[model samples]
Target: MKKFYYTLLALFFMLPACTKTDIVPFTPETDNQLLEYKIVNVQGSPIYGAINQQDSSITVYLPFYLQLITLEPEMKVSDGATVTPVSGTMIEDLLDLFHKGREIKYNVKGKDGKVKTYTLHVQVQQPDLILQEVSTDADNPNTYSLNMNLDFDSFSFGLDGAGFAADLDMIRVMLVDEQNKEYGPLNISTFNTTDLTRLDFTVIRYKEQSDPILAMLPAEGLYRIRVYSYAKVATTKNPIRINLLNKK
Candidate 1:
């Protein structure tokens, strides 16, 4: 009877050992987030996307000419995370029908099967007023001659927008001093469309009719030229700085 009791006790201990439970290890989720986004240039270089962490938004600037076309920008994500809208190193048709701004949605799935959605805002760089020539008035020291070209015409802004076909009134030249002080937002009253790629026009600067800020312009100094579009309410690209003619 004692041997039988010992055997029963031994069987009970063995049964507990056989029923032991295995503890599964715990895993913490790592932040596998998207980092940079970029537009591809002509040279096949990746133009990184700009991330605004404050607003949880991304912005990518394309070439002025390509702004109106569709775009597929590339993205860089965190380790082990995959992003949607993937393409052949470039996202295609990402910015179709570019107005002022376009929004792109991205879905990022991490290795842990968690997903995050991101909004990417895309914009085109401002068109510039390309300087063609600068001439000086032989008769007056304060008077100057400027022959400039508008980088883009009416079609470039938009064909269906309200600003279309209003090329002459759409643009104004903003002059600033070396210190970035505002001088004048001069109007380009007339344009010659002899050149399709650009608009050619001449500007005559007279001290008497010029803005009061022009009076502060030094005889010879550095100044910046900004071409603003009234319709778009934005400045064009390539704000150029030039040295004033040393009229002694």
Candidate 2:
């Protein structure tokens, strides 16, 4: 009876070892897409590209002054995927490609050996205002003058580009003294309507009700004028040096 009980316990323990469990097979990843793209470390601001998965293309709008050849793109791809000309590579031939109206191309491959190509289209944004020239008024010692090219249609619509009447208030004029002391939200004298392309205007000395001396233009100091709209700005290319002891 003791031997029979020991044999039954051994058989119970061995039964579990003999049973089998299902094994899961490995599956290769098929995801191969460029998930995100951006141009970073540019002159002013970082630019993000709009990605269109359906068309497998990306579009980026850059400031007109930004050189395309200097672009180093950062990209993110799907897991288990690799992209050619890897991220953070400067696109040397970008300007030449743009001049020929050709798009920059990138290739991505997945672990399953499948590949997809994506094209990048770059465009330059049009300026709302262009500064042409700036100078000091010889006739009026305290007055500063400048010329600019205005996109009347763009200025009329405002910065958001969604309005009927012209938002003339969007344009501003300012004066900066040698010490970097800034003055004015000065008033523009008037516009020369004869040639809209060559819009001419003048800015007289700024006035303040509280401080008369501060209101008057300094008799002797280096100064410059700044003209700007929402989209662009123009300043004296060279500083205007002044040394008029008799003038107020």
lDDT, candidate 2, at 102: 59
- Give the count of colliding residue pairs in each prediction: 8, 0
Whole-model lDDT values for every prediction: 0.49, 0.58
TM-score per model over all chains: 0.37, 0.39
What ranges in model 1 sit over 4 Å off?
1-30, 65-68, 87-96, 100-102, 128-248
Tens-digit per-residue lDDT, 1-248, candidate 1: 99999999999888867767799998854455677776654456766777864555777766544333345466778788898876334444432323234456787788889877778766556543333222233232123322122222121111011221234544545555556665565544344433323433233445445334334445444444544443133232223333234323
The digit string of per-residue lDDT tens for model 2 on 49-73 reads 9988889898988765443456789
Clashing pairs in 2: none
Q: Pick the candidate with the highest TM-score.
A: 2
Q: For candidate 2, report its TM-score.
A: 0.39
